[model samples]
Target: MAHVGVVGPSSADQRELDDAESLGQGLAQRGHVVVCGGLGGVMAAVSRGAAQSGGVVVGLLPGTDRSAANPHVTVTIPTGLGELRNALLVRSCDVVVSVGGSWGTLSEVALAVRTGVPVVALRGWPLPGDPAMHAVDSVGEALRTVDALVRTDD
Candidate 1:
């Protein structure tokens, strides 16, 4: 199964969380694994959705303490790398999906694109001028984009 990383605001609004959850559920239903930062807001919501759909959810945490991770995370990877942990999150996934993100999420998207991983931006986010990157308006479209760009051999 493909691993899809979700990057978004930790303190996003309800709509953003809803979008994240939708995307997570879509990915999970398609048998794709979900990966995230594992805090509250978007990350927590996505983990919840993925777990509920019987999909494995992995959290690439920023610190050593597993207490900060969401309960839905099936695997908690404590990097202790703080913000630099973003690189790990992006690299661990076969496809990257950004849902109503902030600066940190933007950074993750940038890194994923630079590393040649397929990236799908939900809603609207500034990209690093890569033609391989895709921008979609909804969760369904995001999932479709991910499925299309996924490199199975990798």
Candidate 2:
């Protein structure tokens, strides 16, 4: 199983949050680890989902204080780089699942593409020139796409 990074806004619509949470639970149910920015919104929701599913959750925190991570985070990595930690989060993951569009989430998608990492966008950024980043409509579709990409890369 690979580490999957879930990226999105700290504050988001209820639909996106629900999708992120479902994605986390699905990923965990399959034995994959969930990774996030470690604060709130999508991060907290995904972490909570993974934790609830009895899966491991890692939070790549932007601040120096580990306590800033959401309660669902099983492992907290305090980077102290704030948003710049986005690059590290993307690089550390084998695949990235973006839940909603935010500047931070967009940056993670861009970095994942640049680094040749697979990114399954779930209603995320509409960046030009990367057809691979098209947003999947459901959690099942996203997981299928991620599974295909990981198996292909392997």
| Top model number, lDDT | 2
Instruction: State the local distance difference test value for candidate 1.
Output: 0.86
User: How close to the true structure is residue 38 of candidate 1, measured as C-alpha lDDT?
Assistant: 84
TM accuracy, model 1:
0.93
- Residue-wise C-alpha lDDT for candidate 1, range 18-119, written one tens digit per residue: 998888888899899898998889999999899889889998888999989999999998889999889988888888888886888888888888898778
Candidate 2: lDDT over CA atoms? 0.87
Residue 65 of candidate 1: its Cα lDDT? Answer: 95
Model 2: per-residue Cα lDDT over 7-50, one tens digit each: 99999999988988888888899889888999999999999999
Q: What are the runs in model 2 whose C-alpha is more than 4 Å off?
A: none
The candidate that wins on TM-score is 2
